[model samples]
Target: MKTTLATIALLVLVLGWTSEAIQVQENGLSFSLEAVKRLQEMFESRGTVQQNPRSRSSSSSMCEDPMLPQELLPLCKQRGASASLARLAMVPMDVCEICAFAACTGC
Candidate 1:
């Protein structure tokens, strides 16, 4: 039946996308860790004290911004690792999404 075939096709597409997401996550973890390592290296090279710049009043304000991921927010609060760095680390995954979208669009 057409419906059954369509259902099977959808299932196949779902499985494929899921696998792609898993692969992205695996790759993303390594990429994020490397980013953190590089940031640490840069800080050490600078010989500057690692202290978060945000004051108590600004801390709550920054938390409201959804541009930063919830999981990385805590790390961003730390002295060396910043929200910008965390955002930078996520760039690859964002690119992957764009590439995936382009592929889906037959571009």
Candidate 2:
């Protein structure tokens, strides 16, 4: 109970201390609506850049690397869609795997 109360008191004190840093001064709001609207407007103003046929053909569909293992080719297909899986496929190595390979060499 005492520890919980101390934690709460510390949290309150830290929050109070950083209130100014986290809040907007003009209207006492955390975020400025104008800035958000401007960012939205900027994206809207720029519009979409249409890809040429050549660029479209060169996109993520070419994720299959000839150097990569055949089993990993399927995982590479979803590289853009799944970051963690893509990372795993790209770096499919570990200390244990290296040790096993070294043992197999009989050196």
Candidate 3:
């Protein structure tokens, strides 16, 4: 009985950690994308090329293009609409400074 209880506790702990890791990864990506957007806008306003400094310009362009990557093509074939929709839904949102501040403050 004790062993069973311990197993259950371990499973719960694993699940919690998985969830937290996913959340943190998502948040970090969101924050990064937001920073990119802001930088792009700033550059555009100054008549400079608006590009992500961290990412390869060619790769970014390819991702934005209508044609999907060959590697992702197979996944799309296997999962179809569900996988595509999930990917779309998980696309990172722009990070807000106010949100970041609040998160840091534990608000």
Candidate 4:
């Protein structure tokens, strides 16, 4: 009985650690090389807009909106950054503000 209890305890410990690791990985931000390339392309196309004064206003607006992607919710929750993709909604996006927003909301 004692041995059985020890085995069970070990299993529980392993499972708990595994679950925590999985949660951390899932909640973390992971971008593939392809995604980075795509983001660079998008930023390049909107280079001029980024330089324009109007761009700041638009970026601020998007930063203010609250319709973020579901995947990003966790990161946002951890970071405590709020705001939606309202203004720069026009330009192709790459940065995941949703995670920061989610972190903000969670906090």
Candidate 5:
């Protein structure tokens, strides 16, 4: 178990070579270079899940409309299909108002 942990630690530390070692307690806590080499086998193995391509659809989604029930929706989002049409119809008026405001302010 200690050898396995030491291997894992060595694999994780990229700068372990430049550091000087010290024994705070004794030789009871130490990592073996042989153990680290054994753990390197994992990095040589092939990847399985990463090789597959992502799935996609070409058809237009009917989910373009909101799927929330009426009771769960907020006031602005709880409108019927006709309300959407009314908002769409207001676009020309909104543009006209902006034009009028800009003209009056010489903006």
Candidate 6:
């Protein structure tokens, strides 16, 4: 069991370190190398990935008429997003806003 786990870990490390871009798919799910690295860093730092000030995405840069859920408001604020654009709408625009928010903020 230990050996199996170790081998799996090694495989992941190898795949992740092989190049700047890592793409893998299994069981109909895909994973990104950048996301894997970020997760590993998050774990190593006890859930504290050093936040880069420049990486923070401002709300102004996000889509017009942002529609983030109330729960994500605090997280958005932490990531340097302004709440001025917040609104209550459920439309294609809201879906785009959610996707853009998740991608931009890495949530």
Give Cα-based local distance difference scores for all models: 0.41, 0.32, 0.36, 0.37, 0.26, 0.35
Which model scores highest in lDDT?
1
Measured on C-alpha atoms, candidate 6 has an lDDT of 0.35
Give per-residue CA lDDT, model 3, range 1-107, as digits (tens).
99999999999998766433322122222223333343344334533342432333333343343444333333333423332323332333333223352222111
lDDT of 2 at 79: 29
Over the stretch 1-107, how does candidate 2's per-residue lDDT look in tens digits? Answer: 99999999999998766542321111111222222233223223333112222232332333432433343344444424233222222221242133242211111
The TM-score values for the models, in the order shown, are 0.26, 0.22, 0.25, 0.27, 0.16, 0.23
| Candidate 3 wrong stretches, greater than 4 Å | 23-107
Best by TM-score: 4
Candidate 1 lDDT, 31-78, residue by residue in tens = 233333344344334332234432333334444556434554555455
Clashes of each: 0, 0, 0, 15, 0, 0
Model with the higher lDDT, candidate 1 or 2:
1
- Tell me the spans in candidate 5 whose CA falls farther than 4 Å from its real position: 1-29, 46-107
Q: Write the per-residue lDDT of candidate 4 for residues 1-107, one digit (tens) a residue.
A: 99999999999998776433321122345332233233334434546344552444443432333543344344444432222221122223223323232221211
Per residue, candidate 5 scores C-alpha lDDT tens digits across 81-104 of 223222222223233233342211
Ranking by lDDT: 1, 4, 3, 6, 2, 5
Instruction: At residue 23, give the lDDT of candidate 4.
Output: 14
Model 6 agreement with the true structure over 1-107: per-residue lDDT tens digits? 99999999999997767543433222223334343333333323432223322232433333222433333334334433433222111112233324343222212
* Clashes by residue pair, model 2: none
* Least accurate 10 contiguous residues by lDDT in model 1: 22-31
* lDDT score for residue 103 of model 1: 17
Candidate 6 regions with alpha-carbon error over 4 angstroms:
1-21, 47-107
